[model samples]
Target: MNTDSTRRWLALGALAVAMLTIGLDVTVLTVALPTLAVDLHANTAALQWFSSAYTLALAAMMLPAGALGDRYGRKKFLLAALLLFGVASLACAFATSAGQLVAARVVLGIAAAAMMPLSMAVLPSLFPEPAARQRALTIWITSTAIGLPLGPIVGGWLLRNFWWGSVFLINVPMVIIGALAVLALVPESRSAQRFRVDVAGVVLSALGMLGLTYGFIRFGEYGWGNGLAWVAVAAGVLLLGAFVLWQRRTAHPLVDLGLFQSTGFRWGTALSIVVNFAMFGMFFTVPQYFQAVLGVDALGSGLRLLPLIGGLIIGSRVVDKALPKLGTRAMLAIGFALLAGALALGALTTVDSGYGYTALWTTVLGAGMGLAMPTAMGLAMGELTAERSGSGSALIQALRQAGGTIGVAVLGTVLATQYRSELGTLNRDPISDGVNAGVSVAHQLGDSAMLHQVQTAFVGGMAAMLWVCAALCAAAAVLAAVLIRAPRAAVGEQQERLDDAPHVGQGADASESTHVS
Candidate 1:
């Protein structure tokens, strides 16, 4: 209960709030998209940009941002990011046109890019002890998970009671509180070497991620056969390759290329990428089933998803506790197995499938999602040092968001293909077609018979897509098994290291007690 300890705890809380705000913004805007389109007189492309623009900026800027924080000071950058994020939120709230909203979101994305990785980087400095760090990380991650469940509900409620801009406005108060707290409580931490920002690496990596994401999105809309898609993909690949080479050569690279030497960082990042691919795909697809197939409203759609939210929290907590006993490999393996099994079981769902029946498997899938994300993220942070932390932390988050962008792009492509294939075999028009094609097809039909057919066909597609998710998760499990370090050793090493140091400037009594004990 000394000054430093109190400040550290308060700073952690503030970062947790920042985490909630960012994650909440991700989904809050989703529920309000239709209203936004109506008010702005926007077309489909503009609506796509409303969402994609933020994600694109987030993905592109994260790595470069980390290097910038390292070169400058993390605390300075974090505070600036928070203040600017609030300003951008207000700008977003009053956006009169689709273009105006997109511009504000880009600004928000740049600010968000700073907040996220820096939050991770800041934690170790706050709680240097291994146990303390783990607990802090758990709280930090849990805050993020809480946002996913609460976001749509809050957004829907706000939309029901207020204007769509209310969703963005809600961010105003949180940002103010977070910025003030950070200024008061957080201690500044930095690298030993005075690192310079990797300007070339930044440019190449940014272009690479942006191109890759855009290519996937466009590919979803216009098949891979499109010459533009091929060209875009090639450019993305070439740019990424160049970026990697640049990192290897640069003295103070945007990211530390050597971290890939850690099997944990490599596989954990890979798993995060795939999990997001599946997670966002599921998040979008389920609502369609509830609203279009089950004929539920927005509230009902979100409510039905609660089982998923609940199960995820439970499963993740279990993994957090079990990791000490079961190790990284075992937890990731079991987690992936649960997801694949649930996805395979999901293939059996029909339009007639009751929530009672489908709930358990989807719940299992939720558990799998919950187990995987924080563990992987925590491990990624664990593997980094203060020197590489900013860029390394940024890489972890960048990959996940990139995973989301890629998922939307890839899953969107998969769905379109399956939908077309199913539609061609039917006698219905686009507007009249019921959900049909894959596990996803059990929705969207106002017509009963058409609904049944769509359900049947779409279930087929959903099954196939889930099969892909299954394979990816299963593969990630194998990768984690081979690549991630065992937890027993990691914990022991962290404890031994922590034992030698003062607990992040905790009270002198705590350090004396650790020595005496």
Candidate 2:
């Protein structure tokens, strides 16, 4: 390759490394949750917050973050974000309390919000050719996927040898390397067209998501009878409705309402959200099931996730070859069908089901995600013009993040509620805190019956949650088959069409234009 080509690919690699950190943060904490519950004295609600806080913040700030990067400079904002991410990771590692760690995660999310959109926005500047841009986009996305499987393994090793905090500490070196690489390799780029920041929209979206997530978490902790939880839910719904109205009327909307007019964009985004909802819910519960119920250590639990990752890799490869022939509608239906079947099988898991059984369903689950996620993303992204790519990507990402956040909150609540009900007046206060806590207490008191009860309760709750996910995927399968129309042209042709459109940030060199892919 030529020197310029080598430099561009290297720049893409830097962005990929940065993207890897954000992806790692999504799942690394799952394996550590059991340990956190023990060491930090966290209840189930607190555990939910540990994940939700980050995602909620990401969803809330992503649109604004994209605008900021456009107004300032993508490279400058991205560098600032990386630095902040490193500092937040350190804070998370050294946190003395669960609340402190949650606070730090919010900061990490804010930094990640800036990093995610801005990194993609800089892509066109590095690779101006359509084919090269497509290749770069694939590399960027694959980096994020690669982090999912690595998260458990890396986090497991850290927690096994070091401490619960080491999982967060691991991000430090990666952030440093990514930041330095980005500074050296990536060029600064910004849009020429200035836009107003939507302050009210940001506040409404943030508060609405927080209210909804907190309401579900509260319901999980205190049950459906809590009037406060109901109030929060109601208020959140109202706020979100207001947000949609504001988006339609505002001259400078955070999200472009016009994108939803395309059938591909709408269904593609919806299917992606469905997949994320199921995926996040599974991630939330399975690690706990491995450690608390099956009596595996963190390292063992992490290793167990390898089968799922393997399946995901295989599925993505298969879909990549098959998508051109089969079309998106058929692929999506097949993907969601696999998802439903696998999750249904998982729902039947018993305490004595063994690792082989868990491995079987999880592999299938990962394959389903592999098939659905990429196809869905491509379908949505194909609809964007070069001019709207940055904001459009932000909107899609924010919605997916929000969906995952809601999934954790709702599915976690489902598990907690069912577990508490199954416990049935057996010193419910301590036991209902969490399965891990209950198991620990039972062992300390040498109560075999209580241990059995806690394990059984947790399994029951997990099954219920999986059943809900299975039903959703089944519905999505039917919908995908019926609702998603075949594209008139191939993805390559769509990309060519996008290239034919007027580029944003005109009169700038390839290294300095703000035209996103």
Candidate 3:
């Protein structure tokens, strides 16, 4: 490879490592919660905040961070965000109290918000070729996917051998390496035109996302009966509605509302959200199944997820080769088909089912994610111009974040309701909490019958949730077949037409630009 070619790949490697840190932080805390409760003298509410603070901050800042990166420089913001992430990780490690850790986590989330969108926004500038860009994106996405399962493994090891704070400290070296690599390898890029910041749009979008994310999180924790969660969800909807109306009227909108005009961008983003909804829901439940039902520890549970990672790698590598021939529409249909089939198989799990069965279905599930996610992401991002990429990428990520959060809430409700129903008269007091708690109660009482009942109830609940996920995937497969357009050329002629089109916002030419495809 030439020097420029080598540098671009190296830069992508650095960005991927940075992305891995963000993904790791998303789940690593789950493993550390018990340790944190003991070390920090934290209550249940405090433990929930430890995770929610990061999630809420991430949702709130995503849109504004992307807009800022576009206005300033993506490289500058990304580099700064990396350094800040390292600093916040340090803060989290040293924090003596739950409140302090929560504060540090919020900062970590803000830095991550900048990194997620800005890292993606620069990909077009790095690899201008459509084929090369898809390859790079697959690698980038796979890094994040790997880190999600790795989180529990890493965290479990740290907690076992070291201290709880070591989980946070682990991010430091990766951040340092990523920051230096990004600084040395990546070039700066931003919008050529200077536009005023849309203060109204930023405020509205930030608050709306925060409210929406927090509401779903609350709902997951407290169930549909939580009045506060409903209020927050209602308020979020109203604010987002207002933000959309304001975007149409504002001279400089935070997001280019016109991006939705492209069929590829709209369908790609929507399908991507559907994939995340199923993916996040599975992650939320499966670990619990391993721990509560199968009698595995955190580390063992994490190890079992290896099949998923392996399957994802296989599927991504295949798509990187096959996507050109099959096209996004067909690949998406195939992916959702695999997902539906795998989830349907998973729904057949009973208390007597073995790990081999779980492994078979999870592998297929991961393969489906690999095929669908990058194809859908590439389709949406393929429509973006360099000028609007930051905001456009952010818009896609924002909706995805919302979808994943809602999935956890909705699926958690399904599981919890079914679990309670199966428990019947037995679902009282301590047993009502969750599978883990119910299992603990059964063991403590040394009641074999109660143990059998708890295990059966949890398996039934899990099966019900899997069925719901299977139905969603089946629906998405049909939609992908109907809605997504197949590519007409090998080199992505549609993308070329878009790139050569006039930039949006040039008066009379704006409307013309919106209709490029």
Give the top-scoring candidate (TM-score). 3
Q: Which stretches of candidate 3 lie over 4 Å from their true place?
A: 488-491, 501-517
List candidate 1 stretches off by more than 4 Å.
Answer: 1-6, 427-447, 482-485, 495-517
**lDDT of every model, 2 decimals:** 0.75, 0.80, 0.89
TM-score of each: 0.89, 0.86, 0.97
Q: Write the per-residue lDDT of candidate 1 for residues 2-34, one digit (tens) a residue.
A: 988888988899999998999889888888988
- Model 3 poorest 10 in a row by lDDT: 506-515
* Higher-ranked by TM-score: 1 or 2: 1
The true-versus-predicted C-alpha distance at residue 92 of model 1, in Å, is: 1.0
Highest lDDT model number:
3
Q: What is the C-alpha local distance difference test score of candidate 3?
A: 0.89
- Give residue 145's error in model 3 in angstroms: 1.2
Q: Candidate 2 overall Cα lDDT vs. reference? A: 0.80
Better of 1 and 2 by lDDT: 2
Question: What local lDDT does model 3 show for residue 336?
Answer: 93
Indicate whether candidate 1 or candidate 3 has the larger lDDT. 3
Kindly list the per-residue Cα lDDT of model 2 for residues 1-517, writing each as its tens digit. 9988898898899889989888888879987998899888888778988987886677667877876676667789889999999999999999988899899999998999888888877787677664466456656766776687679889888877898889999888989988898899887766555667688887887777667766765765566789998998888889989988998898767666777887878887898899987787778788889999888876777788888888787877777677777877888898899999999999999888988999999999988987887778777766665544567778778778767756776788899888888887664667778898899999999999888898989989999999999999999999988887753344565566566644656543322322222
